[model samples]
Target: MSFSSFDRKKENSPQPSQWKLLRQELLKYLECFLMAVINGCQVSAPPNRTAAMWEDFITCLKHQDLVSSAALETQSCYLLTKTAVSRPLFLILDDNFYYQSMRYEVYQLARKYSLGFCQLFLDCSLETCLQRNGQRPQALPAETIHLMEGKIEKPNPEKNAWEHNSLIIPSTTCSSEASLKLTDLLLTALENPVTYIEDNVEQKKADRIICSTNVLHQADQMLRRIVSQTMKEAKDEQVLPFNLKLLAEELNKLKAEFLEDLKHGNKKYLCSQETVHIPDIISFFHYEKDNIVRKYFSKPH
Candidate 1:
């Protein structure tokens, strides 16, 4: 019988078998996923120095909040532009913070003056954030003066040496991926053994968060690539850096403690390479193609 034959006023009218076959075909593409485990949860800044920065920056903002929005915008503008600000003002925002606003503000300010390269580093920040503001570095600690040059897709060995330095936004996120970034001995040394062990438990759970997280990251990357590619092919000036970077930032957004642990390098995760057997999606859903629509109502989305 045709689907139109269903009785009038019947929301649960029988569905055509063809509709079920189409529905099952759609589910196949949605199941594939990827995953990675991690260990450690270290922040770029040492705990002591980071705490101090938090205290001081909050105090600075408190004064601005006391004034009206119009007045504050004037002050924020002066701080952002007019005054000859010193090199490298670190703006730290946690995963919970909506930092796209910060990015837009910085991008706008950069337009007026050649601010060198504009960069957003996830997982890591510049080294100076940990250093005392006035004291000179002992032996000129390595600085972020240039981009990690070379091909965008291939590995570049000379990345550490490129000169003609300008704006280096060194981020801990782009460095050593997977287990490499987490569990630095420096951070482990700072931890009290008992609390450290407890943190490890939550970290495992994070690593276990269903493949949904990875799916979201992959979707975002795919969208970014399509966007970047479309823009670049037409010679557009502004093409966003997509892929690992876009994925990295979203990964940091997972509210799960494991993600936080992975971001800051607190909880250590075991990383072992393994092969996968994707679900028998097609066969499983197509058990009986003739009556597929019946299965659609019986099964879940």
Candidate 2:
């Protein structure tokens, strides 16, 4: 139930049966691929050290107070299951999830309803929740630590290796790159006390002269550079759910209005409109900077 090169059949007109079969196969691939990766994270490998890795992991997660424990667990499982990375969806979802905040009630609600209306129902009415996960129990000081002081038996490496292999799953290459970036950033931040995240504000690189974060509307004004990039890429690839022709038609109408305004001295009206040109003035660079182009027409279309 996978698409192959052979399926790119000539299309004078696709028969209804053919369309149905193609859609079914696509649905199966989406479901199987999604489930395989999501399910892969319930890894069975016991940590090499006798101590519970979840304790250390949970401790590390707390510093990222940006994320909730339960949500983090879900994302961790997603990554574990999606052992091998490859696909555009991986970047979109993985990136979005990385920025999410998690909660224990989110987990409880998930169990109670299994995400049926978590977003539409439960989460819609929810206000920001802050739960103080108390400090992690400190491990005995490093100076007195012993490798195997506890009479605990060592974990089975053979079993772990088997589970590791069994746990390996395929994903888009971009997923691996993104995962590594996130991991490296977190690791670097933990390893260095002075590390500061670039302000999420809409400051262009050059605009960040002194790394001043005192800009007017700080947190609420934070720009999503990731979403912006995703949108640009999606537009370039024609993957956005948009009606291009309709959009162009609308723009042309807008341009006509702008032209009419410009014909007179309408410069005092709106700052945005002052620089606008005829809708047909600019051609589409897959529709990325149409608004910008409207402002400054560099060699009209």
Candidate 3:
């Protein structure tokens, strides 16, 4: 019943530009699936490599052109469509997701849709990660592991109020106690979907930007920081060594694009208040970076 055989790591995962679309379609599919479960559909056993009760769900996604016809025949598709005989459905997204912005994207989705959101941080020591990596048939470069060690941003619940539902456990811990705690975590998340909370920090940032004498200078500085942070995040996520140069080129390209849009007064890039918001541009830059990552590199090296 394990989905290990058909995880997203082996598939052409969604690109950044498609992320919003994917999230919307997934929400729709979840609603259909929940309705089906409530209607007492003939659910399959352990839901392993079967999609008998998921026709409606699959059709819903297919009609949106999210999954191709060929993809439907794959084990990954079946795994995605598989359902539990319970009320709540959990769709697990497994990845390195090294950047906070990357994880924040998912958090925003959960908040917007009022879905459950929780983070499980596996605090595996660098030594352990390197050891296990060495044992693998296709071990990643030691340097890559070292790079990730320095770049990984552990869950900081205190710093981030929204991350209050996070749990951190040692990677090696596999006791019944851990399992029970995990079960509780999931239950708690399912019971309490994330609610929209005003971000005072963001509000303050916007106010400062608005009142600044040199708004363009402030924006340029922020954009530079965004680029620098994005490059670091890319490295932290262990982008394939061969694609690092391409990733950089792509990021710079996006920066130029944004600069042009800002300079020439692109209406789409302008806010309703008739002023350019650096945060919006930065967010769009991250989205572009995600697209570049998915297009150039499937997974971390």
Candidate 4:
């Protein structure tokens, strides 16, 4: 199922936190709907507390001609199927998820149900996005697009392990190859959903050990940027394609090793506060990367 951001309109603009709350609520409804369908239920209804929000969301869908008017008369908020059959369901969430955190929320939801999770990042230019937005009958303000352009975060697999299943498709490159790649990505995700053992009360206490992962996440993003810049520099220096490939492999291996060390609480890299010394870690990474690059370039070609 898909929910378009443009279709959802409000008389008053919602603050960032309010928008977050609304998104969470809608996703909750989506989870409920999925559960109902999976259980072979005929009808799905919103909880009593958030019934009004569901009504508003349904109204928005109807206004956009996405749903039939007959849906309004139904006592059940949504009708999944007349007689549900036991079958796999593929859900596609199409939206402009500008923030990484926004997309991560959905990934978390998928993980909760052990469902497939993959995302397609439409790498469109701001100019093109604005042009298309203008062509719409109910066009959004140009300023809103500008604002979103500034806030948008494209998927970076190097930084986020969860986003590794994602594909970044340029706006102009919607070829058959891209379509096939997307199909493959979906199939792979379906075959291999996020796997993790459920945590009990005792295990939850040990969760504190992994709390530093949040810091590591930020560090990973920064480290990837550094590696990317370094590779670009190497390319500019006319590094051979063979050497470039080797360079990338070495850098990625180093990154994995570094991350593993951080995961295991390597005391050498931690500060007095038990937080990661990011600058020190980054410095060590740069040192290792530079050494690796030198080794690749020391000999001829």
lDDT of each: 0.28, 0.31, 0.62, 0.72
In the range 1-301, model 4's lDDT, one tens digit per residue, is 4566532665666776587677887887677666766665533555453665777766654554433455535665454443223344566777888877778778878877788899898899989999999999879899989999998988877766677899888988969999999899989988988765544643343344335646677678888988898788788888989989988899888888888878777654344545556787887788778788887565322
Best by lDDT: 4
- Cα TM-score per model: 0.17, 0.15, 0.47, 0.59
Please identify model 2 stretches exceeding 4 Å from their true place.
Answer: 1-170, 173-185, 193-301
- Per-residue accuracy of model 2 over 91-206 as CA lDDT, tens digit each: 11111111012211222222332221111011111111111112224332332223222322222225222111111112223477656655554444334322123234522322
Best by TM-score: 4
* Candidate 3 residue spans exceeding 4 A from truth: 1-86, 196-301
Superposed by TM-score, candidate 4 places the C-alpha of residue 49 at a distance from the truth, in angstroms, of: 3.8
TM-score of 4: 0.59
The CA-based lDDT of model 4 is what?
Answer: 0.72
lDDT: the better of candidates 2 and 3: 3
Q: Which candidate, 1 or 2, would have the higher TM-score against the true structure?
A: 1
lDDT of 1 by residue, 162-237 (tens): 1112123334334554334333321332231212132555434434332434433343444344334433432332
Cα RMSD of predicted structure 3: 14.3
lDDT of 1: 0.28
Candidate 1: lDDT of 125?
29
Off by over 4 Å in 1: 1-105, 112-117, 120-294, 298-301
- Judged by TM-score relative to the true structure, which candidate is superior, 2 or 4? 4
- What is the clash count for each candidate, in the order shown? 14, 12, 0, 0
Which of the two candidates, 1 or 4, achieves a greater TM-score against the reference?
A: 4
lDDT, candidate 3, residue 247?
76
